[model samples]
Target: MKDLEGKTVFITGGGGGIGGGIAQAFAERGTRIVLADIDQGFAQEEASRLPRSVEVMTLPLDVRSPESWKAARVEAEARFGAVDVLCNNAGISTGFRPLFDIPPEEFERVMAINVTGVYNGIQTFGPLMAARREGHIVNTSSMNGLTPFASFAAYSASKFAVLALSDALRDELAPQGVGVSTLFPGLTRSRMSQADLGKISAGDPARRAVIEANMMEPVWLGRAVVRAVEHDEPYIITHPDYREGLRARHERILAAFGDPAQPDYHTGMTATR
Candidate 1:
């Protein structure tokens, strides 16, 4: 995992935004890339723009579709000897709305892409990494996963699911020597904001303001992911400014519960039971 040079990275959402930035970062470092996106033309276009010497392949992928993931994996393995890394980065927002106000179909759609899509990526490629005993999986959660927002209930829920899944997978995959990294990114300049927010009703000014305030350049977040992979870091947080807020939230939770038992001090104890 430390050595990215010549490693093959299979990336979802590779057509544009954060995914494209990540692909370019790796490609610049001489890593081979397999670009998978919902839009086949965009995927191929991105692949075509990669450095001439870098090995690049493109696949039309609907992250929500298990069959698409299966085909993509098969093609990726066939094109490259084995995928050294898998980036589960494709996701969508449920247009800014309160939990009850959001349509059920919108919630379902967001969950399908944001949460279930990540699960599919892991289920499909996790075994291959386990067999090789040398691979990395990066699942992109969000800052909203760490801190709840009033307007983004569905998106927040899906991201929280991703965060929990990444934590569990890291421990599960440790014995197999495959690295699992979870990313909690603050707002990034991406299609999610443009497409999802643009679709929102014009009356929702508060939600629009919130989205605008959180925005950061996608390339910056992409570079952070590259560093996370290189360092084998378990959790990657893109925005440093959010640390104080996160700490305050943790403190509030601890105050309400009178301090949870420490794992190190409590031996042979299960939190679930």
Candidate 2:
């Protein structure tokens, strides 16, 4: 953890903005990077953007397929040794649509990439790291995961699942000397976000302008991820503007916690029964 130099990092969605940003950050720390994405061309593009001195491998990875994961891992291990850090960053958004309005197939695709993809990455790489008794995993969630909103129900649900998975994985890996961190990025500049904007706010130049203005540079978030990895931090909140909303959500959940509605409900000391 202290010295990232010479470590190997396998990152899903490495072709995208956030993944590229993460690759750059880790490269700066002298870590070898494997950029895995469904689009090999985009992965190559991101790889080309990295420092020439950094060791980088680009591979096509369909995170939804275990076969793809297996092939990627084979290539990665053939190039570099065992992966020291796994970044489950590949994901897709379903645009801003109400829950009932979203197509079931589209909703399923969102879950496949955003939620199940992370799970696949964990299942594929977790044991290797655990056996070694050292490694780290970074799963990218969104600010929406912490504070859900109306139109983004499906995306938010997938992100929420990522957060839960990361938390549980962290607990499970703690004893094995592995670390897990969940990244909550807010309005970062990425292809997926830009496309979502087109879908949800297509002709509204003004709305797009404001959102663009607020979009954080991907590298900045990447730097935060690197710091989190270095410190083995559990949660990485790059944008603090969402804290107030998160606070309100937490408050509501806390308010709902009350004594059991049964007179003879004596469950446990920890439970309020």
Candidate 3:
């Protein structure tokens, strides 16, 4: 992973703010890039920003579809050989609406694109990397995944699934020589984040400005991702300010571990049926 030069990196949602930042970070390391997105235009736009010397390709990829992933892999490998790194970063949010206010379809849509999309990517490319025994995977989770909040239930649930998927995949793939890392990003300037501005600021101009000012740059997260891949780190946390909140939540959960709620139950008992 330290030797990234000449490596081929494939990124889903390569058109978005964070994905573009990731592409840029890898491109800086002389890694060839495949910027795949459902909106091919956005992928191309990001590719155009890279230096001409960098080998970058843009493709239309709907991460929710396994067929789309297969086609993308075929085309990408045809152009630049097998992917050395895979960044499953494509996702959608359910906005900041309350859980009850959100429609069933909206919740399903978020889970489909945010959670299933990552799974599809993993299924498509993970085996190949495992066979090669030399590759890394970076799955984009969210700060909300670590610390959930009201009005963001569906989105938080989807991101939380990403963390679970990444963690399990890491354990399953590490022994096979493939590294997996989960990125828990906080508010970074993106189309999705901008769209939530009103709700986040509660229509207050000063609050809106302050929130905007505090938004992290997408490239910084990308840089952190790059470091994670290089070091084979399991978790990439870009926003440390939320650490206390996450710690508190964990402590609360841990405190609930009392007796198994049954007078005769023992901790080491194994199920026989």
Candidate 4:
């Protein structure tokens, strides 16, 4: 996993901000890349930005469909052999609306792409990587996944599921030499972020400007992702500013673990007369 030169990576959402950035970082490392997106044009456009010397492919992938996943695998493998890395970065947002106001179908759509899409990618590529005994899977979560607020509940839930899935999958894949990494990014420059900013700061131009200025360039996040895969790191936290709040949240959860519910029911003592 350390040396990524010549390795092949398949990235979902390759046409968009973070995915494009990740493709760029890996391309710079001389790794062959497959930019898979629902929008073929976006994937191709991202592929176009890479250095001419890098070997790359662009394919349309609807992460939600098993058929699409299989097709992508077939096409990418045909072009580059087995994929060495899978980036489950394709996702959608639930907007800045309250959970109650979100439509059921819209919420389902978000989960299908944001959560189940990752599941599909792993199912499609995890076995191949495991059998090969060398590969890395990077699943994109978010800072919201760590600290969910009222308005962002649905998106946060989907991302939280990503974290949970990656954690368990890491253990399951470790013996097979496959690595799983969870990427928790904060506010970054992307189509989703821009739309979120608009919803979050409707009339407040000053607030919108401040948030826009703080947005991290997607390439830097991509670079971090590349490093994480190389080192087989489990968790990649791109924004350190959220650490304090996360720590506090963890501390609160810890405070609730005092004792078992039934005081007289001690499992250590065998039930006998």
Candidate number achieving the greatest TM-score relative to the actual structure: 2
lDDT on C-alpha atoms for all candidate structures:
0.86, 0.93, 0.92, 0.93
**Model 1 alpha-carbon miss at residue 241, Å:** 2.0
Give the number of colliding residue pairs in candidate 4: 0
Per-structure clash totals for the candidates: 0, 0, 0, 0
Q: RMSD for each model, in Å, please? A: 4.0, 1.8, 2.6, 3.6
lDDT of 3 by residue, 41-125 (tens): 9999999999999999999999889999999999999999989899999988878888999889988888989999999999988
Candidate 4 residue-wise lDDT, 137-196, digit = tens: 999999998988889899999999999999999999999999999999998999989998
Off by over 4 Å in 1: 196-214, 259-273
Q: At residue 109, give the lDDT of candidate 3.
A: 89
Count backbone clashes in candidate 2: 0
Cα distance off (Å), candidate 1, residue 20: 0.7
- Residue 112 of candidate 1: its Cα lDDT? 94
User: lDDT, candidate 2, residue 96?
Assistant: 80
**lDDT at position 16, candidate 3:** 77
lDDT of 2: 0.93
**Positional deviation of residue 267's Cα in model 2 after best superposition, in angstroms:** 1.5
TM-score of each: 0.88, 0.97, 0.95, 0.95
> By summed lDDT, which 10 consecutive residues of candidate 1 come out lowest?
258-267
Give model 4 RMSD, 1 decimal.
3.6
